[model samples]
Target: MRARTWRRIPPAARRLLAAASAVAAMALLAACGSDGDSASGGTAAVEPVTVGLASGGSRQDGSWTQAWYEGSQTAQAELGDTVKVTFVDETNSVDAYDKSAASFLSGGGDTWIFATAEVPQLVDKFAKQFPDSMVCGVEAPRESYAANICTLLPRFEQGTFLAGFLAGSMSETGHVGVVGAFDFPILTAELEGFVLGARYANPDIKISRTYIQSFSDPAKGRAAALAQMSQGADILFSGVDQATQGIYQAARTAPGTYVIPQYFDSWEQAPDVVLTSVIYNLQGVSQEMIRLAASGELANQHYEFDLKNDGVGKLAPFHELDSQVSDDVKSRLAEVEAQVISGEILVPGPDVLGTTGAGSKLDLATIKAE
Candidate 1:
């Protein structure tokens, strides 16, 4: 009988096991059949590969999870009959992390397991337990793990810096705001980059930053955005997930106010007020990793995608206010972008917050430490 007790394990861990088994199964199947001819008949039968995606929240959360779902879809489409995709949601809890991962591994998935950075310990534990499984952890570093484990981290700081410059240029009141999901190290890094970029563009700029503490709380995000607007903020940048929609809603009622969307494109919400957006191209990365695993070329290393690889960057079409931004300003922004990509300009690290280094000047010590 097919084992069913493994269902109790987390989806992420289950995916790990499934991927390892699939790789082994494929190898065994290939060995049974001769290279030029099938062992039993003239035709060779190919088995469908199963891929499990373990997420920290619902797939429809309209933020990070949603972006991951898109990547999963892309992989499924590219792999066609060779792969079947399944998702296990963790529901934003520590217990859910292990449970979901374990469940995926036990479910008989062949390859491709995706996870968030919030549960690094859980991922490490599972990687050790299932050495053959291929795992990809998003937004975190992978350390001391099996050969099948990898990481997917983006250069969010680079994109946030560009957003800050856009906010600084668009703000008429010389004041801007950032509504963050949480004060985690990753989010803090984005905030630091945004504030620094704004001040670099305009020394007189005033930044009002606040954290909603929840990625899915639209009401709280709306309140935070409105509070900043009331305090003379003309441009609002969002680090919150779906809550960014709430900020856009508030910006619509008040004229001359702008907001930046996170992850995907939010241009449809407030075309006039939105200066630009920071988009993460998770689909491309997912597709590449999936292909690598299928071809037995999966590497046991942490892979970071940034402006250099087009993994993370800005997306603003320069809608209505395009004419307002001068050619000189655009030229300077382009130069900044080149410098950042070429390593001439380093986005300040997390330790520089609330100090003199918070401005245009970057602390070499912090950058070196990172």
Candidate 2:
């Protein structure tokens, strides 16, 4: 659950040259165990397998990094002494992240998780350099098929669509808005999905979208939310990080307004106005990756966590706001979820939605489910 300062090992001449198979490595570990007593029967020691994680953000970011931190703890709890999870946080720069990874490898760590975006290249680079070790890149743009590489892309749009549908159904002003952090492709896809879902639920609904260009600036997020609220948006969705607090704050002042946040369950932050959350389930996904690596069955390909996987792209419980959502709304939400998971409703990815925003030209008729 926590990252510690690991003793640095010089990487110049200490790099592991020979690649070892997982089976061979396991056998070597067993052989290194303390010998059993001859006079009295004694069990061989259980050699702990160490796994390292490198993240660009702090472990307590209350968002992405925090989820992975909890996941590591969960994996360790489940695997017990058989697996050891250690992490190095605040590796924000490329050089820092690479150095941390190299240090981990130099210290005999076979499996390392790169927890952030734009890491598929590094995953492939490290995987090729250390074929014996399993390398995982979280939130990677694409799949890496190298023998020991694991790339991940969580289908967050699915969950966002569900939340947007809820907002569309519940909005009294016939308008909903999204306050996004940036206009990146992934975030754009999520924002577009919300728009599509809202329109699906209520074709007459109006959407107001804004990009604050900052993830940690609460003032900017609040200002965007307030501006949308002034334009008669009764329900709002947040695609920002700590800035989401601003949306929550704005919701508090405007009675009957609701907010939906992404990444993790944030109902506790504003229980009064939080309708629900679009969760990526980073904790669950991370735990699965660690388990696979530990068992030596991790595949070399891109991993997608979607509605069908039951790994990510799910909505959190509606806690205190449960009574506000009608049974009909809940039923429709469930039906749409099944359709998306079954491929009947093919939610478009970012690539499919080119430069989307409020009032953007769209052929809604062409987006129907097959």
Q: What is the lDDT of residue 217 in candidate 1?
A: 79
Per-residue lDDT of 203 in model 1: 68
Off by over 4 Å in 1: 1-49, 56-62, 110-112, 320-324, 348-370
lDDT of 2: 0.79
Off by over 4 Å in 2: 1-47, 92-96, 118-121, 128-131, 139-144, 353-369
The digit string of per-residue lDDT tens for model 2 on 1-370 reads 1222222434432343223355678787766652333223334565567788887667887777788888888998999888888878878677888888888877678799898764556777777777778888754345226677777777877778778888888889999998887676677778878887898789899999999988778999899999999999999999887888888999889999999988778898999999998888889887887887777677777777888875577889999999999999999999988888887877766556524663234566655664
Residue-wise C-alpha lDDT for candidate 1, range 247-283, written one tens digit per residue = 8878877887888876766666667766767776755
| Alpha carbon RMSD to native, model 1 | 9.6
RMSD of each: 9.6, 10.2
Number of backbone-clashing residue pairs for each candidate, in the order shown: 24, 0
Question: TM-scores across all candidates?
Answer: 0.77, 0.79
Leading candidate by lDDT: 2
State, as a TM-score between 0 and 1, how close model 1 is to the true structure. Answer: 0.77
